[model samples]
Target chain A: MWSRSNTISMIFVALATTLVCLYARGWGYTIVQHIGISTDFTDITISAAIILSGGLAMLCGADLPVVLIIGTLGVFVSLTLAQDALVRYLSLAAVLFSIGVYGMVVSRNAVRVLMSIELMLNAVNINLVAFARYVDPNLIRGQLFAIFILTVAAAEAAVGLAIVLAVYRNMSTVDMERFNLLKW
Target chain B: MGENLTALTAWAQNHSETTAFYILAFLAIPFAYGVLLDRRIIRSGFLLIGVFGAISGVFLLLQAQFLAMAQIMIYAVGITLVVVIALMLTNPRLEHDVNPAIPVAKTSGIVVSILLFVTIYLSLRSEIWPLSPSPVKADNVLQIGTGLLTYYSLPFEFASVLLLVALIGAIMLARAEHRPPSQMEERLDAQEDLSSERNDNVVQV
Candidate 1:
């Protein structure tokens, strides 16, 4: 049951990593050379580790112990390998995103599910900011958009939780299975 | 050492491509994991904080100091706090058989979700994102503030009104039920007791 095949997801993640690395190597050589840092080996290693952990989590099912160990190690290693400031930020963001996903899968509560969604949103925000920083330094619109996204997220959380609370009050238990009020 | 540090900062500032590469790679881990993993609340909360920190770093790297600060203050801090608080309020106890009932509409939901994802992906691929040649110099905070106050003022006010309504609704819903007969009977008994005590005091006076 734990080792059900997930070849497609793994391949997709690997392919994405490869494309990202190739792009970085080809277009970012000048910047890397200028910084005088040798990151090719380190970058590949970090990427591979992330892919492995993510793949394992998906295939073997989301066991908290395995996820925590793999995610923590992946985050630490990636952060250590990251030479650029932006890379550091991205590494941190990615770790959070993974943690959030872990929460979403393992959590049984509706509130926890909402929290996980917030985590995922935050991860996206980090990426947007990082990209904005690199691609357009002067234009801070991406950051502005991220703030807007946050406001929307907040409103969503408030409404969602309110609904959950209402449901809980009606039914003594906060169990999702018991929330079959609308079910025919 | 000072010179080297300056050089490093300058190099970071200039290298957009490298910045993009790292940001994407870093973001990919979470994005992939989020989609694949089963939900876990505390882990998700922690992840949100991490993502927020990363985004703030991105803003700083781009030299959008205001944006970075806002991202940290609002999205990272505000949303995370709200979510965590909501989780506490809901108070989910762990149990083995707490899974959501498998809906008969599962097929429809899956089909719709897949279609939506595909549509979004296709649209994203087809569209050419316009890369601005020159970055805008406007302070984003000031612009956002002004926009909210001026042109977007009506919508802002409406949102505030909506929040007030919701708050009122929550209060009404959460309030304890009062049985009319019980309340009236208790009130009558208290009144009779009070009247008898008052008569006794009057006689003593």
Candidate 2:
């Protein structure tokens, strides 16, 4: 359904976002002296915004479910934008983790499964780092756990890819349906 | 000019974290969805890198600078291997792209993910976090290094050993020769013949 121009533009948009994030000099100074920014929009508000905005996007004929996957994430009004809450970070992590779970279950490709597992692990890492920053920043106990998870995830990825390659060598196919050796 | 500058700085200070988070999360979700559902398997591998990079941005937003760098470094290496493996296993030149054909997995996967998201989000909503009054120190890298070497040294050592073991194990597994399906079938046939001979002997006895 994506035209060439549309696809190229999407890539550009993603690149622009990545650049802005990587190069932004100001990393959200608290500036509690200047202004104390807070938001009245809580969890309920965000949830409602996602559903309503996503439904409207679907109505506007952007793709069906993939539009819903992210259409609302970037829609926060500037007034409601800067809610410095632990739950905000935690919620993003949850969304990523859920998508990873879906990938792991639905993908017939073994490599996709491994990628999904990595995604899930990164989700956990986000939670750890969020806790480190918000709850125990001085001690950084959560960052410690995040490091371990990263290590294990790397090891697991390496091993999982090797196993997939090995299986592919023998079977000459990477389809999950074909790898039915243990299936009774 | 000074007034204008202060206004811009104030606005930036107020909105930067949430703006960064939203942008990265926006990038991440679609790429993740692509990783799961893209027809081209190799493309999915590439999308995985996008997802990783965005999450690393999230890490940076949280002020875990060291972990953010580590996220990029580690996932860079890991995702490279994954892409290589995808190339080795799949032929994008073939007529049929790799798509999930299982109707059951499709429906059930969506249902399960929705369930998981709801459970986790609802659970998180009910809980109150103990917020720290103190701001996070700027010297996070130093703290992490000291903690790893001092308090968490044992686990740190254990992680290194685990990495080494995984390295050797992956090499061994990938390097091992694969028995062809024909040879495997031959071996199975030979086993069947032996069992049949044993059955005859039992019948005679």
Candidate 3:
């Protein structure tokens, strides 16, 4: 039999997060005012909608990929509604980062895990470039940092895949569960 | 005909960028979804290319033309291809969905990941990100090039060195083998040999 208790608990958590996201935008107004950047309240309701949808998806036991796409698009759409381009870009990055986190946690394959890590790095790059565009347009340090991060990410992917390949050769399986040689 | 054309152009002139953003998002998100959730692992590799391409388009929208170009060259083409190749090299044929996580583990993963997202979203909501009043430099490419060669020259060189080392390491890992083929490799090799032999026999007959 399906565990209804866990499902109810998940719904509560999702609802809680939705409420938090809606209220948190207001909490940040004073902080943003200090930095001379004005924040918009237009996207809070949208974010709440998204959180609710995500919770519904979980309750319905929808496919993982569908849930991820919804999460990403929800953030993207909400952020795109913002007046400040920096906030928009940063929100997109945050969403991508969370998706990466999800992928890393759920993936069984080593290559998929590497792909998730790459996604996270790319999200960080998005944040960097957004900052460069908005924060220090004169110097453009953020773009430079983004480039370095990209290079480092490439190197990491290559090395990570190599390690995975090496492991595969030895063990004949890329499943993370089977990679507990060090456990014993 | 001309009236319709003019109206279309007017619409494009007004909303083309937003339209492009929507198009690219439509293309990117689903493919990115495929990259993570597709039961077919190999297909996910291909979907990744679409995701990267769409992301580069977003970079273009952000006016990071140089970064966008680099994204296309580096991530869209280079890294994605490498990932696909790695996927092919490592995975066994007929490998469908492999159930690695138990049901409880999966549910927990979902909870944890959603929580993580909520935490990040709340923090971002609470913080103030600075924004420059002025537009980006006109000659962003030139400025970036100069910055790379001058101020960030050392790190730039280090990245190249790191890439070279990684290339060498990957080659060694993938190619070098003293022992006989493992079971999966043997199965793969056998399939290869059988196909080749079949081709040869057909040619002779």
Candidate achieving the largest lDDT: 3
Alpha-carbon shift of residue A146 in model 2 (angstroms): 1.0
Query: Per-residue lDDT tens digits of candidate 3, residues B10-99?
Result: 866897766676677667667766777776777877778887888888788777999999998999898888898888888534247456
User: Comparing to the true complex, what docking class would candidate 1 get?
Assistant: incorrect
Candidate 2: segments with Cα more than 4 A from true spot: A1-65, A71-84, B1-13, B92-98, B178-205
Ten contiguous residues minimizing lDDT sum, candidate 1 chain A: A1-10
TM-scores of all models? 0.54, 0.73, 0.75
Better of 2 and 3 by TM-score: 3
Q: Chain B, model 1, TM-score against the native?
A: 0.55
Cα lDDT computed for each candidate against the true fold: 0.55, 0.71, 0.74
lDDT of 2 by residue, B136-198 (tens): 799988999999999999999999999999999999988856689999788779867965875
lDDT by residue (tens digit), candidate 1, A98-155: 5565555444466666766776777667767655655554645456556556556666
True contacts kept of each: 0.28, 0.80, 0.63
- lDDT (0-100) at residue B12 of candidate 2? 69
Q: Share of real contacts kept by model 2? A: 0.80
Could you tell me which residue pairs clash in candidate 2? Answer: none
> How high is the DockQ of candidate 2?
0.54
Native-referenced TM-scores of chain A, all candidate models? 0.59, 0.64, 0.71
